[model samples]
Target: MKIELSGDTFYPVGALENFLPQIGRVVELGDLPIAVFRTSDGRIFAALNQNPHPKGGPLAEGIVSGHYLYDPLYDWKIDLTTGLVQAPDTGRVTMFPVKVEEGQVFIAAAVLQQA
Candidate 1:
């Protein structure tokens, strides 16, 4: 789920050690479910845990490779940075801003409303 918090400051959800490289971790921000990722190359990204496909797959369980996540449910490739579904699929997931401060990971709680 996506949630919108009224704050400009990023909220710290967990430490860097809490994230597994090349794996996605689900973090709850209020009522929102966010998928946090730590790439093998040391890049961090945050996206909505809900898959945009009709199956309603959990994106956090998807396989992480480079900047893309391969959804295990439907084998759909999703861009971690943009949350855009790679070719063959035509949908986009919500991408959140992630910040690493002093070894702690923080995600912007702002969520854009879809039309």
Candidate 2:
């Protein structure tokens, strides 16, 4: 979680509902491939998510369960809260900061771009 001040950086603000609940997808904010999703409560988050290994499947394509998602690529279950790969504690994804505004989703652009 490295955050630094930059003048060229921009944050995104949008409605959480626009993202749709119970569904997940990979979004590219500038240059980052973020796995964006809304919890059962409609809260959204953006993270540096990807499936480990070249299984020809995306981690974002898995079914999100609570804070984890079942990676369809190799049937591996991942915990989103920690971004840790289950069955082994050595794997994790880089998660970014996300904030919600008045009916919108806000994200740190420079960070996403770097991811």
Candidate 3:
């Protein structure tokens, strides 16, 4: 599982840590905006929070599937782990590396260099 550190800042992308127990939330890492999802199965994904094909508000933009979200606007699946734009969409979004320290989540700025 990918452990994405996100709360209000960006961090480095050094592989990843373990997953956490969460219901998912929005995180701000530097200039990179992201959404962190902690699956019920303990799987974590950090996908680019932007919806190239947005359906509406941040809460109503895409469909969650495992560690990826299916962009509702273009029928594409975005990988939160690598921020990889999969089929239905060609362009990829930004993905930042994250980790949780203590009880708060942290983002690595190095991972957002390309974002």
Give the TM-scores of the predictions, in the order they appear: 0.89, 0.73, 0.57
Each candidate: what lDDT? 0.86, 0.63, 0.55
Cα distance off (Å), candidate 2, residue 27: 1.9
Error of 2 at 32 (Å): 1.6
Top lDDT hit: 1
Q: lDDT for model 1, on a 0 to 1 scale?
A: 0.86
Clashing pairs in 1: none
Error of 3 at 21 (Å): 7.5
For model 2, how does the per-residue alpha-carbon lDDT over 66-97 read when each residue is reduced to its tens digit? 76767766777666666677885345656566
lDDT of 3 at 105: 53
Compared with the true structure, what per-residue lDDT tens digits does model 1 show for residues 70-111? 999989999888889999887888878888989999988754
lDDT of 3: 0.55
Ranking by lDDT: 1, 2, 3
Candidate 3: tens digits of C-alpha lDDT, residues 7-112: 4444543222333334446655565556676655655566556654434334225666676766656677767666677775565565555565554555555432
**Which residue window of length 10 is worst by lDDT in model 3?**
12-21
Backbone clashes in candidate 3 total 11
Rate residue 65 of model 3 by lDDT: 69
